[model samples]
Target: MLLELAGIDKQVGADTWLYPLNLTLQESAVTILLGATRAGKTSLMRIMAGLDTPTTGRVLVDGQDVTGVPVRRRNIAMVYQQFINYPSMTVADNIASPLRLSGQRDVLPRVREIARTLHIEEFLDRLPAELSGGQQQRVALARALAKDAPLMLLDEPLVNLDYKLREDLREELGDMFSQGRSTVVYATTEPAEALLLGGYTAVLDRGELLQYGPTIDVFQRPNSMRVARAFSDPPMNFIEARADGAALHCQGMGPVPLSGSNLPSGAVTLGLRAADLSLQHQGGDCLISGQVQLAEISGSATYVHAQTPVGNLIAQVPGVSHHQLGDAITLHFSSRQAYVFGPDESLLRAPQMEARHGSY
Candidate 1:
């Protein structure tokens, strides 16, 4: 099922919902719509599912234009952020509805199979309202899988779940998607979710399509500061710098030699992810001293906000590290691991692959 959006743009009255953009989804693979709230992910997904027609351009499926075609006429299935289910029907019946509608001879077996995979088999006889939020979402997913539609669209299905529930379901869904043949389009605002899904990703910002490629490729080598900022969690740190003949002169940090790339001598922005900064000094690392502004612990990681001579920066460290407000701290980072952005905010240099460690 090859899905293509050619010059797709949407507008409502005076405000624009989506800028004109083109995208071609790889058939039978998951393509994550990665962005923040109102990044045009849902609007774009609605257009793909035939729920809304683009003000301009066309929607193509397998080279055939399906623009303005009602969603009911297309072989598509969608799961939204909310847990949508038939209140009057049991979980078993909910999963079986699509199978029964498609005239499948073995509806019960198919329903049981999907229910078991989603861990909702135990709640098969119960109504959606009777189950917990996470359980109900599982039932919704089971129903979508049961449809066996060539195109499956999920708009942040796990967004409403608790943290632990979301973590568990994300892993389960990754495994499930790997085994399925459906062309999946899963939308999420979290970079970790996109990385966990480990497929193609399309990054969107303010209704504009910024970059599209393999999940890891886009993450490591963001074409612009906008993509980097959107893909980061605590947000990537930025420091103003100037490119000299063969090095970059960063404020407070001094000169850091450049290599393996050609960047014109002018003003540039240096980007470093919070995860890349370390508290301990390492060989060949540039050190910057600052006073701790705030320290927070979240899920086995400590985030330290510091006010440095150049700018404010955040460093993410492993485990529950203690730091007091107004405490002086020195952060270390390899210049080779930093990203250099030219005047226009385009990427001039990205860290070498080996320098980047661990997953998002």
Candidate 2:
């Protein structure tokens, strides 16, 4: 393992912040610390960067303990949600600062190289205050990249940028980091961004790690309801269900013939994602009847909100849709795309589909 956290715990006075946890980070892949606000994503990053001391446990690198080492001693480069740069320095100077401090010659050429990669070369002579938020962020990232540290950390660095800038920067950063030897750990609250990054993920909720695995596996097979809710966009829909012998039963939908292994008997909750449902019901699909309450058009996709017997549900459909308020329509999704949860909110089985999936 490149990096590992053994029995890590954080406590404040009488309150427990992070439960005793363990994590092993891959050497040369991006790892996303995924969760919502107040989920301890930032805290863990801070701890790993040596800005804070853990209440318990140790931090290790290359199988050796480096617990409580100061940030400067750990060859780590970090960028935060808020842009951090030398206020009085030009963008070029800012990017070259680290190189100069390390006694590297030909700093100007290297600075321009990084600036061009981040698309901030035009603003290289401007002070930090003169650039837009996105440009400032790009400068900060360029500075971090210029360092070429062994470990890289980004704490919601793109969150404050505009939508277009965020999308563009994310793509550029993904490409840049994947080709480097540095181990990268990025923190984000957006599940889509994590999926977009396409790496290993540590799912944190309320300071507790719910799951950790490859990005696609954790998203497709969330270990619990908390992980599912964190991994999904627009939230996942659920219905009370029960397993009897070989058939699974849902209210209003009646007893449906579903195929799966270890089908938990007794009370369970069935989880469904909006993207999995089809507006044009295809064969081998289970049906859910509902009245359309609203159709939200966002970009090229449409989100249909509906009131059903089970509860309020949302469906993500492609292209322009004609769904109207109070119009009754049936939503159908393949049984293989269904997610079943036990009474304890633990996943009973993952979605069984193997075809290409439309993500949220």
Candidate 3:
């Protein structure tokens, strides 16, 4: 299925819900809608699934316009953030609902197969109300998968699940969606989820399509500050500075040189990822000394929040370590790894800059 959103824009009364935008979804491909809260991801997906019509523009499926088509007329199945299941129905019956509606007599095997994939087979006989939040969500997913529609739309389906279950399901679903001739459009607020899915991504902000490209490419080479913020976990570190020839004159800090930069000398914003900035007492042009404000340890990484001369910044370090609050620390990173954004938040690096030096 070739899905094309041409000049699509949505409005509610006098308010704008989504700005005019165009996008093409390849056949059997997964396109992730990455954004922050209320960024219009849901509205965009609903438009694609034919649940809502764009106030202006066309929806083309395989080159045929389906703009005015209703949800019931489209061959798409959707799973939402909130659990949507027949509360009175058992998990088995819930998974089998779509199959039974289509007159499939052998529904038991299909129901059980999907249940096992989602690791909810043991609770197949329990009603939705009897299962935990995660289990009910699995049942909902199973039902949607049972439909096997050509177009699958998932709107942050795992957002309501517990952290562990979300991790487990994300991996499982990533594997499940990799195959099959289904064109998938998944909407989510988490950047990690989009990276885990490993597909093309469309970054959205304030109803605008900020950037669209391969997931890794967009993640590493965010087109602007908006896209960078939307695709970062623990958020991105920013430094207010002015371009000085091939370097930046950071406010309250010294000038830092960025070789091979093509930016014009002017006010700019320097963006660096928390993980990109190394936590160490090292000397470098990109070094910033600060005192620890908070250190959050997650088994695999430690997120240290510190106040530096530039501003409050966070650094994600490998492994857990004991760093007393108010302990002095220095954050260092290579100048090439930083992003140079113009006063308007538009990226100012040469086209080859990201390809040559950008890292996650």
Candidate 4:
């Protein structure tokens, strides 16, 4: 739909809700608003949906200014974290509401199709009150899809669903969006969800728009440390280091070779993804010795938290690895895997795209 927000910002009394920012959404594609709570994602989505007017700037759709347009006047659909539905209406009726409102003659066919896609067809005859939370949310989603709006906004629609249901719906929604023509704006705080959706992302922190680009590009090459932290799941690890004479030195850690690089001699922050650190050493990997503080197993992987001389670090190790508390452990990673951030907290150098992405 080619939605654009130019110089947009929001304020309430003496407090600011969103800092000044500009964004232009890619037409007919998903644009994820990726951020944590109070990161201005919901505020920005409300502005886009015409539910809230920006304190400053304009909301443009297809070259037309929609700054003061009310949501009811716009042909867009929205699904929120809470599943909203008519208490008296059956699931089928709820799904058909939009189609019937649009004067479509074959409401049943369209409703059934959407219900089937969302795996809610079995609950077609049930009322919202009679269905499970996950099932009710699917009905809400199905209704929005039936509206066939040019733009669709979902504000953490699956955030309230159970883990398995959320996982299932996320994949389903991704496939559905791919086949549809709607310009979708999905908001979530999950990096996994953003990665699974594989769309362009706009990373927000507090009230500021941090970075916006292709999801993979932004994930692999964060422009700054804040963006990196926002995109990482367990949070990217940072080590204080000094760059000097073709080498980087960390306190209590041996100097690592910084071959053929021109990183100005000064204090810098080295970032390492949790997945990059491993207990098993590979050739040319720098060793990091530490004592295990906690070992937590989640699904098929174990998250090992350790206290090292440099700092407290967490390593995401694959499979079920057994480790006791207070056990001395050594984690290893190639120096090339590190992300070098300047003293100003801006990314100075990122690992090669081929190596960083392909390693996993």
CA shift of 316, model 3, Å = 1.1
Q: Write the per-residue lDDT of candidate 3 for residues 1-360, one digit (tens) a residue.
A: 899999999999998989999999868888999998889999999899888999999999999999998999888999998879998888899999989989899889888888988889999888899988878888888999999889999988888788888888888888988995699999998888888887799999989999998888888778888888888888888889988788888876667788877578778999988887787645554778889999999867888999998999989888896799999988887776778888888878622333311133
Structural similarity to truth (TM-score) of each candidate: 0.96, 0.95, 0.92, 0.96
State in Å the error of residue 360, model 3. Answer: 5.9
RMSD in order of candidates: 1.6, 1.8, 2.7, 1.7
lDDT for predicted candidate 3 compared with the true structure: 0.86
Model 2 lDDT tens row, 118-208 = 8889999899999888889989999999988888999998887888777777777889878857889999999878887877899999989
- Per-residue lDDT, model 4, residue 344, is 90
lDDT of 4 by residue, 33-78 (tens): 9999999999999999999999999999999999999999999999
Model 2 regions more than 4 Å off: 260-262, 354-358
Stretches off by above 4 angstroms in model 1 are 354-360
Cα deviation at 255, candidate 2, in Å, is 3.3
Model 2's TM-score against the true structure: 0.95
Which run of 10 residues does model 4 get worst, by summed lDDT? 351-360
Collision pairs in model 1: none
Worst 10 residues of 2 by lDDT: 351-360
Q: What lDDT is reached at residue 302 by model 2?
A: 88
